[model samples]
Target: MALSEAEWKRRQEEEDAEPAYFGMTWGEFDRLPERKQQETRQRLSQLGATHVGFWKDCTLGKCRRARRCIGFLSEAQYKAGYNAAYPPCARGEEPRRAKIYYDGICRLFPEGDEQPKYDGRRKTGEEDE
Candidate 1:
């Protein structure tokens, strides 16, 4: 059933109140310990928080299909750009761009890897460890 207009507005307000974080909601991120949050921020900086272009057959979903580097930016900047493009409660199927972005980062910086690598193969049957 369709939500009432008031209910829709309320939800929009709630989404607006909570910021966006990659792979999770802002509220979830905020609930983490203060030190953990700081560590996360620091870690992103240490990794350079570079934006990895979408994989050829990205497992997350259909990619944006751009044939060039998407340009590196800080996490904050990426989040802002994502929100501007696809805000919360956006009507229709969820876009894959954000998930692609997150998955790209993970692939580039898999745990224990001394340096990032470019892997464009599809992760059809791979599981996150």
Candidate 2:
């Protein structure tokens, strides 16, 4: 059945209007409730998060919060962040706590390697033992 003319016009107007939550500004979009934010995030992740042909730009900030919940970044940016955080130990002391793994470990690095071996026995991170 056809919607009444008035009803159809109203639907068209509603479609033309910006979402009440998103309003015409990024600031207003940021003010949306957490529930709404999450919903929109999920929707964006589904659509904008895609890979096109050779011309495609994979760097769009289309992180999938539903999958990992940590947000997203291009692989290059990810590597830079990872390297900046876990640079080779400044003085060659084994990094006590790797930031990517243990952020608070930064405090241990300044303590110096001479402080003492953590345990009577020690092994490299890759060591089988």
Candidate 3:
């Protein structure tokens, strides 16, 4: 059954009302400490390749949010001179917050040796007890 216009609108509003991250806005994320922001950026970088692939596939496959993520990424790439002929989104409704959230999430957790060690002992070069 098709949803009524009112019902669809209500659902959209509810989704919009939900916070993009832990009840915090993009402004809040931006205002976080430099270390925190860097941490978030590192995590986001870990997911960067995957997210880019998802956006590219979505663009080719015509996913619903494709216009938003793809458009934003394409525009950014073009602006950065990475691509010379990227097309603008037809819908013109970029996923502003979604992009910010994803980018922030990407920076959260780092990998490899960059990850912090939690050994409950003195420094490696320090004299042992």
| Candidate 3 ranges with C-alpha deviation above 4 Å | 21-78, 81-129
Any idea what lDDT model 1 has? 0.45
Count of clashing residue pairs in every prediction? 0, 0, 12
lDDT of 1 by residue, 1-129 (tens): 999999998996687558544565666777788645654553342232224333333322223354323233335544554332321211112344444335544566566857668777656655543
Candidate 3, residues 1-129: lDDT per residue as tens digits? 999999998887676665544466555666778545544543343244234443443444443354323333344544554322122221223452344335533454433587567776766655653
Candidate 2 segments exceeding 4 Å error: 1-24, 48-129
Note the Cα lDDT for every prediction shown. 0.45, 0.37, 0.44
CA RMSD of all predictions: 17.4, 22.9, 15.9
Q: Is candidate 1 or candidate 2 better by lDDT?
A: 1
Among these predictions, the greatest TM-score belongs to 1
Q: Estimate each model's TM-score.
A: 0.26, 0.21, 0.24
Rank list by TM-score = 1, 3, 2
Whole-model alpha-carbon lDDT for candidate 2: 0.37
Show where candidate 1 strays beyond 4 Å.
1-22, 49-129
